[model samples]
Each structure stands twice: as C-alpha cells, then as structure tokens.
Target: MLTSAIWLPATLAAGLFQAARTAIQQRLRATLSVNGAGLVRYLYGLPVALALWFGYAAATSAHLPPLSPTFFGFALLGGLLQIGGTNLLIMAFGERSFVVGTAYAKTEAVQGAVFALWLLGEVLTPLVWLGIAISVVGVMTLSLGGKGLKLRDVFGALWQPAARYGLGAGLLFALTSIAVKRATQTLGDGDVVLRALTSLVAVVTLQLVMQGSYVILRERGQWRAVLGSWRTSMWVGLLAAAGSAFWFTAFASAPVALVRTVGQVEVIFTLLLGHFYLREPLKRAEALGLALVVIGVIASVVGSG
Candidate 1:
C-alpha cells in the first residue's frame, strides 16, 4: 500500500511549482486582465496536459478507463471551482501585496480538512490535527500582520477587498480539492499515474471550454491580449501543468487533507519568490511567520509518519 512517504515529495514539488506559476501569473496581470492572465493557465496548459496523457498511454499501451457519471460530476464541479478560485486569487493580487494575498489563500489547508471530511469522509488523527492547527496559526500570523493584529484592524481587514477575496478563494479551493479527490477515486484499480493524468486532461479540457468561451464572448479584448502574450503565457501554462500533475498524482496516492497540510510549504516558496524576484522586503512579522510555517510542516510530517 502507498504511504505518506510516497506522496510527500510530490506535494512539496507541487507547492514549489505552484508558487512559481503564481508569481508568473501575477506578473502577467500587468500585461493582461485578470481573466486573460487566468485563461493562459488552462488555454496553454491544455496541449501540454493532453500530450503528457497521450504520450504515457502510448508508451504503456494503457487503455482509457471506463468513465462514470460520478467521475464527470466530480470533475466538472472541481474544474469550475478551481477556475473561480484562481480568479479570486488573481483579483486579490490587485487589492494588496502579492505575499499577503497568497498567504490569505493558504488558509485553504485548514478549511480543506473540513471539506475533505464532509465530502469524502476522510478523518485525521489528533497529531495531524495539531499540525494543521499550528500551520493555521502561522498563516494567520502572516495574514494578520503587525498592524492587522489589533482588534479594530482585524475586523476592518475582513471587510477589505484583499481579505474578502482571499477567504472566498480559500473556501472554493478547499471544495475543489475534495471534488478532485472524489473524481480520482472513481477510477478504481487504475495505475496512479494514469488515473492522475486522465483526470487532469478531462478537467483542463472542461476549463478551456468554459473559461475560453467566456473570454471570447464577454471579454473579447482580453482574448486578443491572451494571443499577443503567448511567449510568457506558454511559461505560465507549462508551470501550471507541471504543478497540477504533481498535485493530482499526490492526491491519488494519499488523503487530500494530509496532502494539503504538507502543501502549506507553498508559503515558504512564495516568500522566497517575493523577496528575491519581486524585491519585496520581508517584515519581521513575516519572518517569524515563515519560521512557524516550517515548524508546522515538520510537525505535520512527523505526525503523518
């Protein structure tokens, strides 16, 4: 049987790739509108995902798994929720500092466990829950910043655009994780890699059709922007596909809650990206928060073991 050891590395890799992809997508926002930059992820990623799935199938002579209504239902719902979550995160970028925006969404790990339990009937042990609580405190420490820790400030921040969008994004993303996990389980007795790839292909295709159609009909100008920026968009797509492939594979191998808990390391990657690439200065509070996150992740891993 596959264990947390099997899935841990994939989750860490996904976090790294996802952090980089998000940084790229955030940069694209300067050149393109929110939805346009968002479209690059699915529109460009479709081909890469398709190629990987087909190539693996050809190499292994793996036949397509039988699809069921439950599979389509989960895939469709998860795909749509992810698109919404992505846009909300992008929109958060516009409202506040990139690091803070991303940190707010990292709150998804805590909420994800609840959604996983409700939707998939997955439960966690006491130690794992302690790890999750520690991680949540770290994230909250970062999100509530020095100035934000005051009583009045905390209430005020919740109503602000960045906080509102970030929290909403977190909730939607939590739901998306649960849905995708359910979708993968529908492919009973299939190869882990094949199951992950098949689900990714289907989800990405659905996103392209739905998101692409919206861009064309409602945001025609953004459609042109998407075409004009193919060079950078391609990088965004490549990273998005790589990150998602790792994520799906990890989900197939382990419980979604544990995967997401470990996935919180994306906060560390985001901090590094912000400091080095964007030249954003790290505040003392942020530095402390980062240290807490590392501790939380370590505790979570040990607990899983």
Candidate 2:
C-alpha cells in the first residue's frame, strides 16, 4: 500500500524533482550545447530507467508484458514529440523574450485538456476545467511578471517567432502526454507503476537512439565537456530519471489532462526553490500567482476525487 496509492503524490514529487533537474540543467547550459545537455539526461538516465523497470517487474512478480504495435506507435510518437517540443522551446527562447515564450509554453495544460478530449476522448469535470483555467492564468501571470506585459501583449503578438514556437511546443507536449498515456494503457491491466516504468524505458531508449545519434554526429565536441562536468551532469541524469518516473506514474494512474493540470504545481516548486535555494526575490505578482496555482490544484484534485 505504500506505493499503491501514489497518483497525486507522484505528480507532486515529479514537479519537485523536475524543478530540481531543471535547476541543475541550467548550470549545465553554461558548458554544453542545448542538445548536448538534453542528451545527457536520456543518455545517462537510460540505465536508471532500466533499473527501475526491472526492479518493479521483479517486485510485482510481473512478467514482461507483450509489447503491442499501438504501444510502440504511441511510445515513439510521444518520444519524438517530446524532443521536438523541447527543441521548439529552444527556438522560442532564442527568437523572443523568455517571459513571453514561457507564457505561451505554459499553455500546455489547457492544450493538454483539449488533446486528451480529442485524442483520448477524456471528458473532465467542471471543477477540473475551472482548475485548469485558474492554473493557466496563474502560470501566465507568473511568466509575464516584471515584464509589464498586459493581456494584450500576451495575446496580441501573433506574428512573433516565439508565438509559433512556444504554442507549437505546447501543442506537441500536450500530444506527448496523450500519446504516453495511451501507450501505457496498451499494456493492459498490469500494475500502473510497472506499466509506466516500462513505457519510460521504451521512450527513453527511443529518445536516446534518436538524439544520441544526433549528438554524436553534430555535437561530437560536447561529449568531452559533458564528461568533464560529469559531477553535475550525473545528478542531472539521476534527477531527470526520477522525475520522469514519477511523471509517468502519475500519467498512468490518472487522466493526462488532470495530471497535467495538477502538474502545473511545478511552477510553484520552481518559484519557491528560486526564492529559498537560490536566494532570489519573489515579486508581488509571483506570490499572487503561486496562490492561484495552489487554488487551482486544489480545485482540480477535488474535481478528480
């Protein structure tokens, strides 16, 4: 029972670990290319993912489930979309302001709801919709903070490169969530955590093969730097693996939209970490934004329950 009832808890833990991983990955950015740094997680995290999968398989006395065509399809689609979405975010960050780019990227929650509805035919309760809306607004407010961005600035910049890149990333990420969720379901009624771990192993392996090849061909030089700073990079991998495991767990246990809507708590974790760990100042809007996020998460949980 310790791990049996771990849906929302997994989501919360995923946010924390993801926040930590992002912080570490930020440090890696100083020395490695974006692709290289991104590669480190999947490259190094593969072993961890495999270990977790096998461990759970043994723990549950579960035989390796037969992999289905639908599973592979969604797994591959989710992996590829995750990579593409991440790359689009890089483009958005490069081509436009972080505030505006993040504001758009944060729309993944709402987009996820739509994707879940369209792709997975998941219908949500009204309270969950309220949660999604409130959380999204809070996220945008937090993102646009200190930039003097108005509602008009956020919506009016349709022609900007960031708009396309950020929104595209958001949609792709939304799809990735749906695809991953579907992938797990194809495994039948095995343990949810085991199903999730199995899917994580598959997706991470696919991503590693795809991205690892690119890194080897294009960013050959980054390997040396990546290894040189392995002390930090290793932690990045571990945190990434853990974060991904928790997220996959949550995805398997719940609706993707609800999972993502609740997952917006990641922003709160980010802000709090910045304030306490990094000694950063919390702006007024940010404080207000965090409050709204909390409210939204509560609403989402209550609706789901």
Candidate 1 lDDT by residue in tens digits, 1-305:
24435588889999999999998888998988878988999989989999989999999999888899999889999899999999999999899878878888887888998888887787787778888888877776777764535677677777889988999899998888888888888998778878888999989989998899999999999988998999899989998998998899899888777888889899889889988988878778776777778888888778766
Backbone clashes for every candidate come to 0, 0
lDDT tens per residue, model 2, 241-276? 898899989888888888888888888777766567
* Residue 119 miss distance in model 1 (angstroms): 1.5
What would the TM-scores of all predictions be?
Answer: 0.95, 0.90
Stretches > 4 Å off in candidate 1? 1-4, 146-153
Instruction: Please give the range of 10 consecutive residues that has the lowest summed lDDT in model 2.
Output: 94-103
lDDT top scorer = 1
RMSD (Cα, Å) for all candidates, in order, is 1.7, 3.0
Show where candidate 2 strays beyond 4 Å. Answer: 1-5, 90-104, 146-149, 156-164, 276-280
Could you say which candidate leads in TM-score? 1
Q: Rate the local accuracy (lDDT) of all candidates.
A: 0.86, 0.80
Residue 259, candidate 2: alpha-carbon lDDT: 82
